[model samples]
Target: MQRKVDPEGLAAAAFLAFLATAGLFYVNIMAAIVDGLVSGLAFTDAQAGQVAAVNTYGAAFGAAVSIFTIARFDWRKTSILCLVILVAIDLLSILSTTPMTMIGIRTLHGLVGGLLIGTGMGVIGRTANPDRSFGMLLFVQFGLGGLGVMFLPRLVPLYGVAPLFLSLALFSLVTLCMMPFLPDYPPRSVAAPIKKAGTVQWTPLVLAISALFLFQAANMGLLAYIFRLGTESGLSRDMTSGALGLATWVALAGPLLVMVLGRRFGRFPLLLAGMLLTLGGNALFHWSQFGEVYLLANCATGITWGLVVPYLFGMTAEFDGTGRTAAAASVISKLGLASGPLVASMMLGGGAGFAELINTALAALVLAMLLMLPPAIMLDRSARRPSELLPQGKVTA
Candidate 1:
């Protein structure tokens, strides 16, 4: 029998997913935060990159830990504790004077942030439709994230970076109030062992996860330097922020498009198209001197990101019914995210132009596209196999 949809459960899951993935949203406004640190605390470009990288490193660790520990605890309580810790940590970040200090604080923050995100993914995995649930989750994230990107530059100039940290803490505090509505654990069937345990395939799972990591790395590599790139292209801080905001708003169409279409088109086709769009966007950034071109590039990349993430998450869930593979995929993806800015910084050294950043990201995207193709073919073939069909006509590779 088809399961009944729980409206309240869906709402709680979407809200928690938004709050849990705060780190992802933080990245959207990170350029402003890095600028504030540079101006207020005398941080170098490399130091700023370190600050961004450390958080993702910590998040990778947290996600790994979640793979082992998430099944042991109640997600509601776990989320609350994580949020409380995040609030305290964000407040303490205000006192960080040196790059090392900031790195330590952000790394610790990422650990808890990763746990929240993993838990949220776990919740989404338990839903009637993981794809639609994740789509809603991203919708909330991008909608609010867009607003933050739009306003953060103005706020940073007027009130400095301290307000940004404080605002995040405040948001966490508000999200804490909604914990009562969320499920403590996934449904029993979702947590049950697979009937054909030892017969489970691993090759496609590894390929998909690897592809996701590369895709995210390429995306973040460029994103981490967006502010610098924009400024170098002769755009003002407000203009850059506005462009990102518009791009973020445009990204909303991605998940909504998926939700409405809902498997009418196969995942690989959409995934390939999104990847190509993102690659083209990266190329545009490399050649374009005008702010409008940059803004259009951001829009394309944002839309692609939105379209790709849910399917990636769904792939992981399909690979492992218990959600461990999804959690592991999160770890890999977070590590890639951590590495992106570090790699970009290394390429930049002391000072590099927007072209260099674009070139580096383009290379990463090309590699990701290549790696993704094999798995896309494998997944599409598996979907078409007669024996691989589930009861509802869903394909399980």
Candidate 2:
């Protein structure tokens, strides 16, 4: 057998993946600041949305490359290169001053983003046993990664845009420093010399990916404009900003709660519960006139996003436990999550209003619920004997 990676070391490696992932999110605040400065060039909300979507677009394309490249490339090498690329992309932003520049840079960033994050998924598959749930592990990554996003709003008041970019640059730098300690996750199987790397069955994986795409699309579509929603509803920026900050702070707890609940109830029910809360929160966004309601919406956002972010990856592994599993997941996210805001932003075809955007998001949410029905039903059939499909290993840390 190829050297079985040490569990302690592997977990440590996974945490570093989280550190880098969180750094990407942390940099998003800078992306937003850059956007504010750059949006003047965008003729329509849709165009501005596309600029935001560039990362997702690049990520999706990059995932396709990962599908082929992961087999031949050293994942370790790819990761380091991508981290360096992230810094280069951020540094290049100083020279950019228009919507096109934003799109191009974000796209490049996403490409590197896809290679780096997808490699982390590939690493997790090779290191862990069949029974190890990716959900909790993925949560740890998202939770840490989310710290950047969670605190992004706060950065605006402290550093302004240029320094905000510099701050994000530092986060990426820290992640890069931590990289060498991570495990090398080559997909090539040990059982056969000249063997093929791990690859997943496509059908169920597609469904699983679709489920995540819809989930993220719904979430991002709404969040892309959430502050605007709050402002329109008469909530002050101070109040709305507090709500956003609190959501990030509390999100770390949501998955832990679900992980505990998952012991008794199935993962599907928690997903349903999360979706419902998200819907309710969106409704409140439409009608809530009070600061407290905005606060509550943040809680709902944090909880649902927290649960869904990691849970989404777990569902992919459930569908297919292969190295390519992460690639499939990344593909779905790129399409649904990346395109979500762009599509949502243009809800009225160049005439979208606040009411229309809310309606679009609500519709997307409804669709997400619908998408879950088929998968949940199928997973239900196997739940009684879930052990048969996933095999067995130590699940919890």
Highest TM-score against the true fold, candidate: 1
The collision pairs in model 2 are: 22-145, 26-148
Clashes in candidate 1: how many?
Answer: 0
Model 2 per-residue lDDT tens digits across residues 218-268: 777666666556666887656665666566566667777756666367667
- Top candidate, metric lDDT: 1
lDDT of each: 0.73, 0.61
Deviating ranges (above 4 Å) for candidate 2: 1-15, 19-47, 129-160, 183-208, 309-312, 316-326, 385-397
Give the C-alpha lDDT of model 2.
Answer: 0.61
User: Tens-digit lDDT track for model 1 on 1-397?
Assistant: 4343254466655765665565455665666666667655778777888888888888888877776666888776787888889899999998788889999999999888888877777666666666556656677777777777677766766766787787678778777766655554454574343444333347766767777887888788778777777776778878888888888889998888767865567777888888899888888886445888989999999898877766776676565534446556678888888888777766776677668778878887777777666766655665677346222233231
TM-score of each prediction? 0.88, 0.79
Which residue pairs in candidate 1 have backbone atoms (N, alpha carbon, C) closer than 3 angstroms, thus clashing? Answer: none
